[model samples]
Target: MKKIDWYFDFISPFSYLQGELLHTLPAEVEIRYKPVLFAGLLNHWDNKGPAEIAPKRTWTFEHCAWLACKHGIPMTMPPHHPFNPLPLLRLAIALGSSPEVVQRLFRWVWREGRVPTDEIYWQALLKEFDATPEMLDAPGVKQQLRANGEAAIAAGVFGVPTAVVDNRCFWGLDSTDMLIAWLRDDPFFSSEQLRQAQQLPQGVHRKT
Candidate 1:
């Protein structure tokens, strides 16, 4: 089976949406979920999130709602836009509960509009998985998350909901279609195509 690396951060609603659509991938493909720090990547790229800017921030909220509706996924914006998702991410990683508990977390935050602050809520969330809060403070859990972030940066992933199949990266939730299409190709991109693509001048950086 072809292995695909799915890099994401829960802070991104797009990532949550993409999780819902993973079933669309070919059955022959195996997805490896990687939880990375979104903020870490943004800081490395010196980029600002959509919510950090004006007009775009407003558009982002509207767009998130529209996208969720379009995808037919239940969504209600979390009370906090950019709250710390480290605990959530770490818990998922420590438990090795990808696409299940992770999916639940997405729904819990976006669909249920809950921040999960109370210990009772968290215990309830992880009850089925048999995960304990002690796992959050477990040694190397934080380091592992950091390593995932650095590895993502090394792999040219600057955003969440990125799918990497055989070292080719497809970014953003909307790119899932294209990523699946790439997987079906008998022959991937030609060597000449890559050469021509890389030789082209870099794109103009837009001011935020």
Candidate 2:
């Protein structure tokens, strides 16, 4: 079975939408979540920061709402964002190999809009996984997460919810359906062709 590498940022609205329904992988498919630093990409592209990008931000909110409606997951604009994706990203990298924990945290934050910075929130997020909050802020977690972010850049990912299947980069949440199909080798899901012809809002960075 091929593993789907999910490089995601909790701060990404699209990723929030994708994450909610993303777990329905077939028995042969496995998801590997890499909590990546979206801030670094924003800084690199010189794009409008997540908060300032009005169109992207608004689109993110609406897109999430639409996906929530479709998936039956309750989602709302987070109370706060432009969150330090650092800690969360580190948790992903530190536990980079653990899909169980990654899926748990992803659902907690996106489905519930829970920010990990709050100790209680972290506790609640990790409870299902039998993990604890203190391990997140352990010394060097932030720095290590930063290194992972650098690795994301090296991997040619410029945005959230990147799914890399065997070194191929699917750089958007919208592409997950294709990612899934590809992993399954479902003729109906031609990931390679979709990657070639992905119709995305290009040339415009999520408008602010």
Candidate 3:
């Protein structure tokens, strides 16, 4: 399977947008949603953290609102971001199958703008999926999620919505389609060097 590592933050609208966009991929392309602390990655990258991530935050809400309407996916981001996604990341990791959680979280945060901190929001969000908070907060699962997060960082991801197709990192949901185009278009891999190049976060790695 050609694995696409999807690095995303629950708070990121682009990540949310990308989650929705992912539905367009052909089933042959296996996608692995690797939840990472984008905030932490920003802190590690530079001094201006929020200021940098803020635009991404803004971009996600605006574009995704339109995309949701276009794709028939409900989306709303106002008042406050749905929740501190770190916990949800942990939950996804714990679940060991974050596709459903990632999909659901994107809906609640992007489509509803409900913060994850709100117990009521969680209840409502999980209810839609026929799930309960207990599913996300299962025993021994949180610690495992943390480990998965650490593994993402170790893999050299510095931000959310980073997709790796053939180890070529594509950041943001906007780039997702392009990434798929490259993946599906056999001509893209014309050169062996291009195919074998290392693709990691910009500062730490190169996109040769």
Candidate 4:
């Protein structure tokens, strides 16, 4: 079976949306759910998240809400954007990071609009997992999370909701169709124009 590594974080609404659509991939494909800290990626790339910018943050949520409606996926923004996703990431790793656990965690945050800081709801989530906060804090779980982050960087992942297939990083929720097409062996992927596109030279770089 073809394997795709899905890199995501609970802090991203796009990640949650993409998780809902993973069912659309070909049946023969295997999805490996990877929960990585989005912030870690930003740090590695010396980049800023969409939510770090004021106006982009507004547009990002608005666009995601529109996309959710268009796709008929249930999505509600959490009480806050860009919250620490380490706890949730560790929890998923601690629970083995299965598709079920990852999807459930995404829904807990995006579908239900809840954060880990919400005592009552958070407690209920822990009960559902048969786990406690202490369990999530285990050193092994934390180390696994770190390893996932390292793996993501090695895979050239600069964003969440990325699907790494054959070492090609298809980043963003909007690239789902491209990913599906590529998986089905679309000829455009092998076209000369595509090859040339990859060789395009940078005209300029923005001053840091």
Candidate maximizing lDDT: 4
Q: Backbone clashes per model, in order? A: 0, 3, 10, 0
Candidate 1 vs. true structure, TM-score: 0.88
Model 2, which residues run further than 4 Å from truth? 92-97, 117-134, 137-140, 184-208
Model 1 misplaced regions, further than 4 Å? 118-120, 186-188, 191-198, 203-208
Index of the highest-TM-score prediction: 4
Q: 40, model 2: CA deviation in Å? A: 1.0
TM-score-best of 1 and 4 = 4
**Which of the two candidates, 2 or 4, achieves a greater lDDT against the reference?**
4
| lDDT of predicted model 4 | 0.92
Better of 3 and 4 by lDDT: 4
Worst 10 residues of 4 by lDDT: 78-87
| Local distance difference test scores for all models | 0.83, 0.69, 0.69, 0.92
RMSD of each: 2.6, 4.8, 5.3, 0.9
Winner by TM-score between candidate 4 and candidate 2: 4
Decide which is better by TM-score, 2 or 3. Answer: 2
User: Model 4 segments beyond 4 Å from truth?
Assistant: none
* Model 2 Cα lDDT, one tens digit per residue, 39-150: 7777877756546777777776677688778878777665687666555666665564376666666666766777867777776656755555566676666666666678
Clashing pairs in 3: 7-161, 13-60, 75-111, 76-110, 76-111, 82-114, 82-115, 82-116, 83-115, 83-116
